[model samples]
Target: MKAWQITTPESGLRLAELPDPELRGGGATLDVLAVQIPAYTADLVAGGRGGFPLPIVLGAAGIGRVTATADDVFGVRQGDIAVATGLFRSGRAAEPEEALLGWTGIGGDGRPTPTTDRMRDVWRDGLCAERALQPERTLLALPGAETYKATEQLAFLPWLGIAGAGIERAEVRAGQTVAIVGATGQLGSAAVLVALARGAAAVVAIGRNRDALDALAGLDPRVIPVALTGDRGVDGPAILAAAGPVDAVIDTLGAAPTPEPTMSAYQAIRTDGRWVLVGGVRQDLPIPYGDFMHRRLTLRGSWMCSDSTILDLWSMVRTGVLDLSLLDIQIVGLDDPAAALTAASHRHGLEIVVLMP
Candidate 1:
């Protein structure tokens, strides 16, 4: 097996011939089909994300074909097509620690501890190579995924599941309006589609990229793109005018320099509307206490999706409720991790890079 190995944060990714992963208790070995290379993978590999276990395979959530499962592993059987969610939870009753195998997502708190490190040490091999060993707990079997011709596009399903979960947390329903912050990004784009599939009357897609925003608006008549101009007054009024008063606002902004854009969207929501934070924004949100108390608003934080959500997303894809064809996927090979990482960066909504091993 040829797998991309990272010995140290600064060492970068190197392709090395390694032994194929063997099934272990509570785990399953998979013949990896496709892995979506995230836009920040280059920065992650360059030590910009965070530290992780060394001498490990570096990849995250993707699709795979089950080759074998350990005796303790049930539900996911051999010859089944499943999505390796890359998310592993401790299932601990208190402060349950979690980690993204082969990637840098630490615990639910995004802070590392001994428990998270141990979790990564055991399941360090991700779905980046031709073969991978994954925890059965993280594998969700996709019944009819075997017939899905667009494997590369299907690799993006995990993200859709995540975004769909955000929408679900916001309690979005048919005939309601949604405001997706950072709508030009990959997850935001998925939220737009999910919002539509969930029967949202309109999706006010808000982002900084005009071209990408325009592209989203072009997808469906229900999509209304709003390009941010950094001014909260201007952007907030624009968002409010777009839909009058949005029923839910899904904040998917990543590492924003300022929280104004998010706040702008937040203010545009209706009095009793919901706000769900599903992004990596690293700022302290300043919520007006009096206004928040009076408005009876609901604010929630959602990170990853549950198995049920992933199954629901698969059903959406299978039933044509959500069109995976809308995504413009760029396929890359396994040998060149450097090139793939480079290509993965700088791509916006519907424009993605997938590694087909």
Candidate 2:
């Protein structure tokens, strides 16, 4: 089988003919159809994300058809279309932190311990290949995916799952106005759709791109687009003006160098409203402790979605509430993943890149 392998930090990715993965106990082998190239794939390849080991296949989310499965893998069978839902390791009484599939190959909280090192053998390789072997816990079967040509929809599962988890954490309710920071990006756009599908009275799409904001607003009349001014004082007021006193805010700003944009979103939140952080903003936010205390604001951080969240999202997609047809998907081949990675980095608006392996 051919796979894209990252041999070293800051080194170029190379296509290598690797041996087929062996399906072990409780694991299944998938004939990968399509895998989403996240914006951060380049960062991971360049060793900016974390201490991911070398010689690893670099993808976290994909949709595939099961070609084979172990006798113990009972959830799915051969010929089933399944999506990778991140890696999950069974918890022990002593240590119970679950590690994800892509970067965190070793499944634990942080730092590679002996337990994680041993578990690395199970999850080291990701989905960027002709075939992938994944544990049963990480694969979710999509029953009529082939009939609907849902491979494009699979590209969105990771982002949608993250956004859904954040929205769920914010406890957004029906008839309440919700604001999605960085709404022009893929994650933010997904959040807007999810919020609307969940019956939010209105969605405020806040971002730095005017054209993208306009495009999002055109999706639904209830979507109110607001462009960020970059000035903290002005942006906060702009967001509030467009959304009209939002009840909850889901911040999806990724790797924001400064805290101003996020702080502005925080300021725009209504009193007692929840602010959920799911993005990759790196700076430390200097929140006014007293103001936060008096306003009764709820601040929460959500990392990823659970099985239930994925099930709910799938149901919404199946029912037509979450319309994925509006998304612009770009499919590429595994031979030139570098070009796809570059394209993913420069991607804006509703455009998303997927690798057809």
Candidate 3:
């Protein structure tokens, strides 16, 4: 089997012919169809985002058909189409810690752990190959997925699951207005569709790209795009003006050197409204304790999604409540990961990049 391997953080990705993965107890092997290289893959590979012990395949989310499964695995059977998000449970679902399949992605605290080598044997490999191994718990069956002619869209389920879980965590109810920061990106776009599907009276799409924001607004009349001015004080008012006082805000902006944009979103929230952080913004936020206490604002953080969350998202897609057709997907081959990574980094609007193994 051919796989893309990174020997070290500084070493670039190379296509290597590797031995097929051995099926472990309670595990399944997937004939990988398509894998999406996240926008942050390049940064992760180049050591800009700390280092991971290398000599590993690099990919997180993908959709594939089950070719083999251990006798103990019953969640999915041979020939079933499944989605893998690179997340798996070790001890129990109720346990505080979980294992991410690709890199040292995220752990118990819903944050990436500093120890890059923890679970190195399990997470050292990912879905960037012809076939990949995963615990049965990480595979979710996607019945009739082929009929949709939306393999690219199906590749986004991992992100949709994450965004959906965050929206759920915020307790966004029907007939309420919701704001999605960084709405032009993949996760943000998913949140917008989920909010609309869940019956949000209005969905505010906030981002720095005017054209992308405009494209999102074109998807639904209820979508209101608020272009960021990069100034917290100014952007806050802009968001409020467009969406009015939102009932909740889901921030999907990636790691930022400063927290101004996130803070700007914070200011747009109404009193008692919830602000959920699901993105990679790395800076520490300085919240006014007195203001938070008086306004009764609730701040929460959501990392990855659960299996139940994935099922809910799949149901929405199957029922056509969450339209996957709106996304513009770009597909590439595994031979050109650098080009794929470059394209991923410039992601905008509903454009998503998928790698075909």
Residue 243 in candidate 1, Cα distance off native in Å: 0.5
lDDT for each residue of candidate 3 in 1-357, tens digit (9 for 90 to 100): 989889865678888889999988878998898887777778878876654456888777789989899999999989888998777656544655665777546566545443424654655688999889887877898877757676767888888899999899999999999999989877898899899999999999999888889889999899999988888889999888986889999999977778998888777789999999998888889899999888899999898888889888898999998888888888888787788889999877588788888
lDDT (Cα, 0-100) at 231 in candidate 3: 89
Q: Residue 215, candidate 2: how far off, in angstroms? A: 1.7
Give the per-residue lDDT of model 1 (tens digit) for 164-255: 99999999999999999999999999999999998999999999988899889899999998989999989999999998989999999887
lDDT of 3: 0.84
| Top model number, lDDT | 1
Model 2 — TM-score against the truth? 0.94
Estimate, for each residue in 1-357, the C-alpha lDDT of model 2 and write its tens digit.
989987776566778899999998988999988887877778767766666656687677778899999998898889998888765665685766566665643333446766665555457788889999888888888777767665766778777888999999999988999999988888898899899899999999989988889889898899998888889889888888886778999989877789888888887788899999878787888989999899999998887778788878877887788888887888888888779889998776577888888
Candidate 1 has what TM-score? 0.98
Candidate 2 worst ten-residue window by lDDT: 102-111
Model 3: how large is the Cα RMSD against the reference?
A: 2.0
**Candidate 2 stretches greater than 4 Å from native:** 104-112
Model 2 scores what on Cα lDDT? 0.82
> lDDT-based ranking, best first?
1, 3, 2
C-alpha RMSD values across all candidates: 1.1, 1.9, 2.0
Find the 10 residues in a row with the least total lDDT in model 1.
100-109
